[model samples]
Target chain A: MTMPDSSASLPAAASASAPSTKLHAVAPTALPPGVRDLRLDFFRGLALLCIFIDHIPGNRIADYTIRVVGLSDASELFIFISGYAAGLVYMSAVAREGFLFSSLRVWRRVWQLYVAHLFLFVIFTAEVAWTSMKFDNPMYVEEMNIASFLSEPHIAILEALLLKFKPVYMDILPLYIVLLVFFPFALWLIRQSRLLALGLSIALYATARIYHLNLPAYPEDAEWYFNPLAWQLLFVIGAILGASTRTFANSGMDFPVPRNRWLLGAAIAYALFGFGMQFLWEHDLISRVFPHGSEAFIFPTDKTNLSGWRLSNLLALAYITAYFLRADSPMLRWRVFHPLIMCGQHSLNIFCLGVFLSFAGLIVLVEFSDSLAYQLLVNGTGIAIMIGAAALLAWYRAKERMPRKPAEGPAGGANVKSTALGGGSAE
Target chain B: MTIFHFSRRGSLGWRTAVMTVLLMAAFSPGADAAEATPPQDLAQFCAVPETVLPNGFLKHARDAYRAGKPLRIVAFGTSSSAGTGAASRADAYPARLQADLQERFTLPAEVINKSVGGQSARQMTSRLEDDVVSLEPSLVIWQTGTVDSVGNLQLEDFGRALSQGIEMLEKEGIDVILMNMQYSRRVELLVNYSPYVDMMNAVATQSGAALFDRIEMMRHWASSGRLDFDNMPRAERASRAAKLHECIALQLADMIEKAVRR
Candidate 1:
């Protein structure tokens, strides 16, 4: 590629060079790289869909669909995407505006996340309280004391400052904030050299795995539902991708097909080996090393440690996705894929609104049995509502971004309706 | 090529030998006999007593073990009487009491426990006539005060409701064993409970029903450090207490068993 022009659409030397160097022009018709990555969006949308299905009261399809697709529970997917998006967006900020700007941006996002968390915490607590009062059932109330709620204000303030809190049902935001706090450091290392970033990421992974140390998800006395120590690997991987994108894209890193039959045979054998390992793991063959039902061995397990099994599986999945479902593959461009893309596009708004609506919907239908039929009815309704919500959000965002007085299109003040229709890009 | 072949052959042979050894160990002759047997089932280890009574009030039940013509007793209370917090259901006081009755007397009796976790005396009382008395038990082990005290149930209401339960059981000639509340897991919390237990004891004495003072036994265990409530895990302590409770339960069961037999 030519040297980045100072007066180009992109800002400067560092900023323009990095993201562009990584993007491969497989399809001429594809959108610009910085504006949007369809693959990431598609994956995010797929995660949301899986999560919705899984959260439904008693859907039979959820179990089978999730296990097969590796998106059974969306906790890993959500957090993984969070890291990936942070790396993409924050890394860009660091490249353009330097460390201070990126650091401030991360802090701003943390504050926003904290506010969202607080709102959720209040809503859930109020709902539980309301339900308890109405039911007058002791069983309905779980660990509720007025002291608990009163204590929260002090803890939350401390958490906002220190980026730590005691593990509660609603304390994931603090963990994310803590992760993002290190973005400047991560970006600094990446800018210094790609090798340093790679080495640091590997070192972090090794430390977490070898020491088996888990940093506090919450305060000193709380259990983290999702251990950030293990989850950090996902973010690190994303950062590595963002940092070395230039090298990876230009280096002809594509997995070439085996010309010699022996290599293909070996690949098949190696795949079988992986499958064999899984089978043996399931049957408790290697009991001494890994006891069956070992906390680490569980599927999409409680993100405690980046267990070898899960990490291996993720690697295998990534390989398969890269080889078989590469960016410009016809499989990804199917008409059926549009819904998932929409969900991914409006993810933040959709997730927030969807989760709130789901809870409300469940409460409204509380008296109904958690039978198969009821699950179908609820899930069907949920899917429809999510679609409707996405459309509404998309429309609103589109309107907000557009100027009231439309500028003349290419034809000297001729009405430029085409840009509004098909050319509507990301905000 | 020759070196590679040799190395590969050696590794493969090693792998084969290891697998063979594992298979041999797993399926060797008389291996089944050599293996340790699984623990006996709950039913075999803990025999539920069976008995029949004239008016269908099961006798000799500390909690739900009755002996008579109908041979059934109902024990309805909170988690303690239900025999939770023990290593096994067989280790629960009610089961131990049933076994003791079986050994003491020749009466056949069955003890059915309808106790649930986190139940209060008032909740138990509300369901007394239906869940307990309706079972046509020859004996009713009416344990309530601990839950009532914890719940801060009105003492006047507690006494009246308990008396009402006793009256209902007695009308059917069902011997009622009024058990005092056991000591709390946290010894300091006992103060909140013991006075309520005493009130229950007073009602039992006034009504002329058999009294099993579990609070005294548990307090003794705790003070003597025999149960080690403070040092041990709550689960372990509960199990130790269950053994002590089982001993008292045995005596109560034997007394009822003899009366039923006579």
Candidate 2:
């Protein structure tokens, strides 16, 4: 998921430091009441849960995830939402504190994600190494792509630090990090003209596909799993939609919410087509009609280049979801979805925890019998852990924001200050 | 006699003659001729002990090759088979094996890799219909058990899934080669891998599939100093791994040839 930067929460501070420019004369769009939109958080939370289950490989729980019935899966949602959220936070920042401060804020977030990616790499490598050694299975390191680190410590570590080498599931974050690093520029371009930004993004994506362009992986002569050049289109689209939210707000305009019956019907029909196509593809029925040679041209679903089919499917799904699930819907506020909401609210932390937990879950599924009951227990337990961790983080942040006790005076103020510092470090 | 006379005439000639005799002794057919022989270039890398395949192994691949049809072999498994450590995709064992088979038999060959890194046997089983059976390959080399063992998956479930996968392949008239795990120093210490290996062996025997003992072969390489896992410098590891993959390709080709010929 594209993690929203600290600017998302500290909009007041951003507005307080606003420069007196003509840009500010238009008046900044009001920030969302809370740090997150409930709809975005709920879906992102669901995406995280799906990702956890999918990563476990042969588990029965994987069958129930959206990917089974649809062309676009959690990866699409995670990335799109990330872009949307980043646009929401940063654009609001830009509208308030001007472009310079907002860009710095986004870049700082990129740095934070990069550091987190490295930290995760080290921990994941250590986990594989420790497990392999403890279990007498050095091949596990090789299996998980950690053998390069062991065999070529200096080069591999350097490449990893440079973000050129990423282990298996560690790939997506690097994609997010790169996109986020360039997001400030994209946001600015988008601010200038949405059509121009979108046109540039789509043109780059097309060029990447035509030229087979991608960032090279170090040590291995392969390309990044999620090619930034191709994937930028989706992120840019999400961002543009997000930026439009503010642009519309400031100008007293509103985004068309798919109210037209024909548009809604088209969206449903498109979604159904995607589902049917994916089902046929999964069953290998589609291959009979579209041979391997013609498949790419006819229905290009290649994930690396983010093919046109995938993009269309994502757009259709997004449109349908947006039509059905408004941000302030009572269904979203229901207590049943609180876990997902909490998980979404604390996405960056929960995503990391989800990765580690998914690995742990795989081990559990393998170590124990992979019975239906056991699989359910494992998946259920993992979801609980993710939700619990999110809740814990939320509680900690809430406590940090609690007002100081008046009777305790300076000591209470000092305590709150230390707690806030601790919370910041925790994030 | 002439060579002996030349050797007596000069020390250099004598050295050349001795080396020639040793090479002949190594390559010539003996009472143990039924044992598979690695190609001359790969002899140094042949650390594996002698292994015998059941009669008619790889018959489908052989039949396809003989008919001048494309011999399709799917390399199915986790990272090693998926080309994780290989410098390039072409350097992967399956691709190298395809090259070897084409050259050896003078026929077109397609070695499709249906491996995903970090997948266990159970996961591989779930994907069989789409990844393997749908490819319509004549032969499948399934490198599994490593992830299952590493992940500590249930032995019974792993066995059942593996058996079911092999059964499905056999029913489709595809030749099956069950490749065991690669030897790893760290893994040897941390996991009791013998049970998993034994389970694969049993499965291969019961299902009439050939078992490619990669674990023992890799261990032999490490023990015989052919592959230096302990002290090799970090920078040279990729080259070393590439060499290992090449050696594996050579060994796999040799096994297929022996089976087909038998």
Candidate 3:
């Protein structure tokens, strides 16, 4: 019944270090030793694939994604993994380099994310515009909700630059950028006390739900699809776990998280309940028990505000995953699982690529046939391309680390080969 | 130097010839007419055929119009009918149609929008008793098939829901017009809407309901180059959409008027 202790299993090199105030003193290399966690990458990669499949709208394969069987979809998994990784990376930076330097580092990453979002925006708009013109169908632009940009370019451009006019599939990154901008404060609070940070996050989520607080969208008088106010709770919870693992490594003191049989049983029960409800809802059978208007106040699991049901379901799923799926599990070491690990390592790039690929998949589905073979072909090709891109990126990054010399090619290649085969630190 | 001289001269001559053809095509009268015709004014731009409506359609609306009583028509469907891309509720097809009908018949016409966003035919069917029939409308323009097709709902199930929904409305002696999915490149690329489109037409014919072939009409405008949705400048997209809605309304009005006169 014991919850898996991530800190207890850390490599000796990681646990040997105590909290230090010169984080940047250790030069920023491609990856720090003993920091890469396969578990994080594995789940993140899985989430990215689910997101890609789900975005195609009507693909038959989407039914197999986690959303059909669970209340919370890949969004929760993606954001949670991001937070966990951030906690590990930034908290270590804060402990080693001190708050000011680490905060700046976090902010720099935020800037990168913001730039990436804008880049995606430009490309997505162009894709829609070009396709619309080529096919002589204006509805593409409108369907993607970029009609505003077309109708009012000046104002639309200004609002988009401000991260206010996010179209479909483009909304998530803006929310992520906003969250990362505030990551430093969250990390600082967690460092002070994990419970304090968790408490504040829960309070904020509750307030948001009660008051309907959310950021506004530009062009459309609607709130952000993923309300940061509510979603920050999941992010903070992940950060706490991530930071606690690091804290245990530095101070040799574990965070007090009860891992009793009752807790495990409760988590299992809740997860089963969620799965059952999701199944019933999918079949349109749940209405028999919870008649439409009767459960109006309590029903219809809301994703935007991260409703109580969704949050609980996600927590249960997370608990089950943590309990069963250890980093050192033999199942994870299989050749088939390597792609997920690689994709997760290069998540940002793969995710961006996946978005475009999914759109292309959509186009193929619409223009071609909606037969099972076509759906499978489009989805399969898109995923294979994603996996291939990740592998190439991994190889390139590995190559960069090798010492340069014409005669040393075989030795350098061997080292890179071993790294890939061994599945060492993902970073 | 000799090779460079010949290549450069030949390239310049080819470029000049291509430019000359392009210029001629741009200035051609037919091309200019198609491109320049403002799509906003349907009466001016659209060559809508007379009697687009089926015979014996809109009997209730006609009777109401003749008796000088207010004609009630419900524009019922998913987001398009509810007006997702429209500038305003007034800019939606139903509103435009209401305005057109009222002006043409010289009688008060009320088009209630009972449409919901993101609802499939099945979901709409479930709400028919409350949303559509309960309103006691003389005519109901049901825009359907898009959501079901995009959602990948079973074709048989979709057909059943549509048939059931139409039966419920018609049983109340309401004239039903089945508006098929909008023709959009994005939608065309995303889902195979052909099956749903074909099924909708079959259902409309079998049920004796007027089929508003919106997709066909839109395709006509697009193919004729009367509306270049893809290449249209961003500044004019809103106006373009507004005009498209107005055009749909005008066509719908003509269909209703023709049916009533017959």
TM-score of chain A of each: 0.71, 0.82, 0.83
Using DockQ as the measure, the top candidate is 3
How much is A303 displaced in model 3, in angstroms? 1.0
Tens-digit lDDT track of model 1 for A251-354: 22222121224433443454555555545433334333554334222332223454544444444444355445544455667878877777877776666555
Tens digit of per-residue lDDT, candidate 2, span B140-223 = 989998776654445556778988998888898799999888875434433446547767765665566888888777766654
Candidate 2 CAPRI-style tier: incorrect
Give the number of the best model, judged by TM-score: 3
**lDDT for residue A138 in candidate 2, whole number 0-100:** 29
Question: What DockQ score does model 1 reach against the true complex?
Answer: 0.02
Q: RMSD (Cα, Å) of candidate 2?
A: 18.2
* Predicted model 1 interface RMSD: 26.3
Q: Report DockQ per prediction, comma-separated.
A: 0.02, 0.04, 0.06
Give, for candidate 3 chain A, the lowest lDDT window spanning 10 residues.
A15-24
Candidate 3 clash pair list: A23-A96, A23-A97, A150-B234, A366-B189
In angstroms, the error of model 1 at A417 is 16
Tell me the tens digit of each residue's lDDT in model 3 across A1-427. 2222322233331433332213323424222334365778888899999989888755679889988758888999888878877886677667667999878877777787788888887766655454434443333322333333555667766877888777566667887888889999999898877767877898999899898787766644335668899999888877777776555534222221333356568889988888887786555455456643343332355677887788778777776776565433457668998999899988888988888777767655444334466678768888998999999998998677655545567667555544442232222
Q: Is candidate 1 or candidate 3 better by lDDT?
A: 3
Q: What is the TM-score of each candidate against the true structure?
A: 0.52, 0.58, 0.61
